[model samples]
Target: MHDASAIPDAPTASSPRAGHAKAVAACGLTTALTWPIHDILDPVNTVMLFLLTVVLVATRWGRGPAVLASFLSVGLFDFFYVPPRWSFAVSDIQYLLTFAVMLTVALIIGHLTIGLRQRADEANASAKRSQALYTLASHLAGAMSIENVRQHSASFAATQLHAELSLWVCAPDNTLVPATPDDAALPHQAGPDVARVMHMVHHEHKGVASHQLADSGQLVIALPLTGSTRSRGVLLLSPLRAHDPTLDRHRPLLDAVTSLVATAIERLHFVEVAHQHQIEANGERLRNSILSALSHDIRTPLTALYGLADTLTLIQPPLPDRAQEMSSAIRDQAMRLNRMVSNLLDMARLQRGKDAGQLPLRLEWQPIEEVIGASIQMLGMALQDHAVQVHLRSDLPLVHIDAVLMERVFGNLIENAAKYSPAGSAIHINAEVQGDTLEVRINNDGAGFPPDRLQEVFNLFERGMPESTVPGVGLGLAICRAIIEAHCGRIEACNPAEGGAQVRFTLPLGTPPTIEPESEGEDRT
Candidate 1:
């Protein structure tokens, strides 16, 4: 059989008054059992029975029931089981020891049992709190937005603690305000003191409670949403009461919730920044495509018009001197426009990796003087006002490159020098074979690029000077860079030791292909 004394009592639905009556009846029954077992009830047995009642009352019912059980045990022992049966009087002097021992044991047991049960209840509550925090953190970790996290957190606090809840977060602009409730369409606003506490928690990484708010009737718990070495925001919970005793007891759980929110907010922030960068990159690409189309479609007809005007100027028995001069001027201006359009098209092709002609380098042995003379002939018109000088090493080995593209590369560089330098300035072109590589430099005495603008000068459509004053659209240097780089070469610009800008490019050296020897006995030789 199950021992009645060992079983914990079920929770009672009785009022405090009715519970007192039930406890008295239980004490009376135990006294009666003592009377039957011993003709004269043993003081020790009465004491033991009284302790049992106190233990049951404390564990299941709490302090009120334990006090009632204590007093009832003393009364029952005196009336039913004491020396003078059925009376409040005792016949034996030793029976006074029985009464004293029974009452004292009842009081002591009531105190000790109540203290132990209170401690056990506290432990159970702490464990439940830890579990709640774990659940909240797990949910928050998967949340994507601050609003979602706040709503879930507030709902958890409200349901678990049985209180109305509100969460206040700090905005990027550093304003502390309460989050609106879902049920109501109205906005939630925090008072001055509440806002102050929220800000303090955010900046200091400290917790603040509702009582800290001066006029707020609700208990506000401010928990900091903090990260490693930084405080991100604050979580403000407004519970129904001035202070929920249970919430105070579970402060650690609330802190865990705040930490989870902080981590989620930081992750979302970086994700948003990355998304914005992608959007901007796409916009830049689209803009570049539009510019390329405008340059090509608009300039094709202009090139044909310029070629016709030049042909008409050379008509037999040319119309008049003035008319011929006007045609020549129109052709020159049209040619300039043609060059700008070609630059745009070339840049577009280079960017899209569609120019396969630039690959499969053709190597050959060619004299440096011959290459320089060809490039000068192509750019003779542009360099008419400037004096051109070519300095080549007598022992310079033949450099390897695509002859057609390399001529264009040299022509563009010399043209750029002439355009930037003064009318009478001397533009020097120098070439030499420098151990396994060929170095070519074009220098001019003119105002050099600003220190900060040196690198920017090579970007597509990036002009060294304003377009209204300077002639070209800044595509010359960019084309120069592209052509040189395609030849497995490098180019750079810097100020010379004296003054002016000097641009240099280097190409790797390659040996000429060997030719077959003729047979000595061949009569044709």
Candidate 2:
């Protein structure tokens, strides 16, 4: 921040500040020159010359000087220019009338001249300030970032008011940090006290906080950068040498400055957000395009490969032991690859469904246990090594869900549990009624998920052990989350205290249609 000093004033600024001495000198000079004109010129003509002197002083100097010149002209006219020269006494009473008229005319001309000059100076100052404001708005409109905004603002402040400035922008959490990254400290290098004040300014959402340094009487102002939607931050202006009256007078200019700055900053903020969103949107479209194209392209040949391998073992005359094992291995790898491809296709489909604002659901009221059983049957051999346990309360309520999609959810979770857990470990499935929803939990006694990555595991391609040689590309949990959310349910993963990972999901228990019993008196078909 720079030191305080006022900007250069224009030409008219000097007029109103004229001293009494200058006014007296002008009057004295007029009288001395008129001493020579006393004998040569008529007394009335001499009075006219004195009146003109008063007008010049008023226009050049200001109101007070003009009034002083007015009085001096009258007295000098009475003693030196009247009939009884060098004396205050008058020869003819008519000359007294001349003196009275001269004084009255001089005062009126001086007063009017001074008022007109002051008005003209005021208008010029206002126009200059308005032009400065217009220039500032132009610069701010083209500002690329907060740094650019602060730079232009500081330059304007220096040029217009001779002040120093810095901008502190608000973070999402309502904390203030320096808008300029070049600032070596956070909100304030000045300390926590100043930081608190800056935070307060941002929180208050309106008005400026000001203080005058006792030593230098320099004005420091903290102005809120309030945008249309929110308060963006604070703009700090400091070390203004202008006194209280000047600040009060220029307060509107400062407000307009902050308003312009706030508008520019918010525009930049949204532009950055829009640019980022566009990039993400482009990337997502590309990923989905690749996934859809590859999945469809590979599925045909992949199915043929799996069938050929399965046929090798089923032939009437089996191949040699080594050949048989190789065929089995080939079949197993193809199945794994097929599952991966199916996952990619499903992911792309779900993404498209979400963009269309709804998932494709053939929803019905069905027993959740049926979906669980179907999922286990579908993954028959995969869960052979793990003991599967299903614990459902006898009074479980029917849930409204897409039966096929729910089955996929259970299957993905069960298979994921088996893949991540040690062989022969029990994968626990439990369901119970909790309030208006049915809560279900799938637990596996593996090392559990990484404590820090429990939530992240559900993000696409975020594996629990990223570097570990897991046989998955980490799509199962993400798919599960998308399905559960589409059903208007909630899902979360956590490590249970029992030393294993658990995925819990809840499905809403809607009002199921009543099932009427068969009427005993029904007519025969």
Candidate 3:
């Protein structure tokens, strides 16, 4: 790697720098050799030789060495090449001007040359580091597992960082462990408290920490392995020289290495998560298929059982009072079971990937009030104890929807309210045309949803009161959301200001048809 800091600082007289000595000696030797040529050439031409020496020193080294050569060149020229040879005094005032011009011109040329060299060195170093970073990133992108990340990261750190390297991964239990267990015999052993520091860095997700190693007392740096959102782990580098000046200069390269490693680790993490999700999805699909098949088989027998129970009450002779009551109970339980079966079947249909995308729905313009009344009647026994109040705007527009599915939405919401609310508490249904859409709300005067769990109520198998005697696997609200969204609408649940649970949904109010009157009796002839 090219290090821009390798260019020497300004030379001081107290410090015996080798470059300064070399510059001064080269200029002095050239001046001595030019002494023999002094009688053969003009003194003005001798100044050219000294200027050439200064330029060479400046290009090869830097400003410190170039400055030394400049002063030495002028001194040698005045001592030997001037008219009064072997002396500092000048024979003519004109020669004094020559010495001044020679010194000034040499210093200026040396200064410019040194600046150009320094800039070129900096550009070259930047390019080299950029290439290194690009190469590391490419390799990291191909990394498929945490082990691959560990190997690539460690190798780059060892080669480019010039320090002993180790990657510490934050385990699921929050313990810090070596990225590769087998590579534990590396140079530095971390302190026991290093995990605490790693945890702090990962949680803060900012800044690097320097710690003293336990066994060797060597300084090591711990930088957070930051993904796009969270921290992955910590990168620990050891055996960095104490008070090293160049370490700060290479910080950007170190940061690039951290970014590449963090990204690789995060990618591997999500890949594992996706694989697990796919497996779970496959299992869920199988379970739904089995439930759907069983529900289909049971529906026929359940219908028969309900019919036979009702038939018992219709015997030629009037049945006994107890028998009539038993038949009513049987019918009610049968209806409840059938509703559950229908919900499961609806879930299965909605969850079918190809069906949701390709299956057509039976949709038409219909009155929302009709769907609401049908849902209430379907749940007659269930909501018999609860009072239902309907508040609808007078000019409610017709909504374009699949009537059967929209009825299901109202049924689920009303049934959920009836089940959760106290007996005889009123369930309120309200609707109005708001702009180009119709918004409907169903609220129950009962204990509202638990704090901050309004959205969780719509997740499959999630319950508002999980431990309560309420009989549901929590698929109702999820189904309702799916149906409403399929109609290009939105649904939301919230706690009302007056203490109750409110579920509101909306659907587009499409343009209604207009009928025209026929002309009076024109076609009678």
Give lDDT tens digits, candidate 3, residues 383-437: 8889899998777877889999898999999999988999989999999888888
Output the lDDT of residue 177, model 1: 54
Candidate 3 local Cα displacement, residue 331, angstroms? 2.6
Shift of residue 400 alpha carbon in model 2, Å: 2.5
lDDT on C-alpha atoms for all candidate structures: 0.72, 0.83, 0.80
Which residue window of length 10 is worst by lDDT in model 3? 1-10
Candidate 2 structure quality by residue, lDDT tens digits, 484-524 = 99999999999999798999999999898988988989886
Per-residue lDDT value at 397 in model 2? 82
Per-model TM-score versus the true fold: 0.56, 0.81, 0.66
**Residue 524 local lDDT, model 1:** 91
Clashes of each: 1, 0, 0
Residue-by-residue lDDT tens digits, candidate 1, 391-502: 8878777666768667767877898888888899999989887777899989998787766788788877776666436588787888778877887788988888799988
Off by over 4 Å in 2: 1-56, 79-86, 91-120, 168-217, 222-234, 239-252, 522-525
**What RMSD, rounded to one decimal, does every model reach?**
9.8, 4.9, 7.5
Model 1 sits at a Cα RMSD from the real structure of 9.8
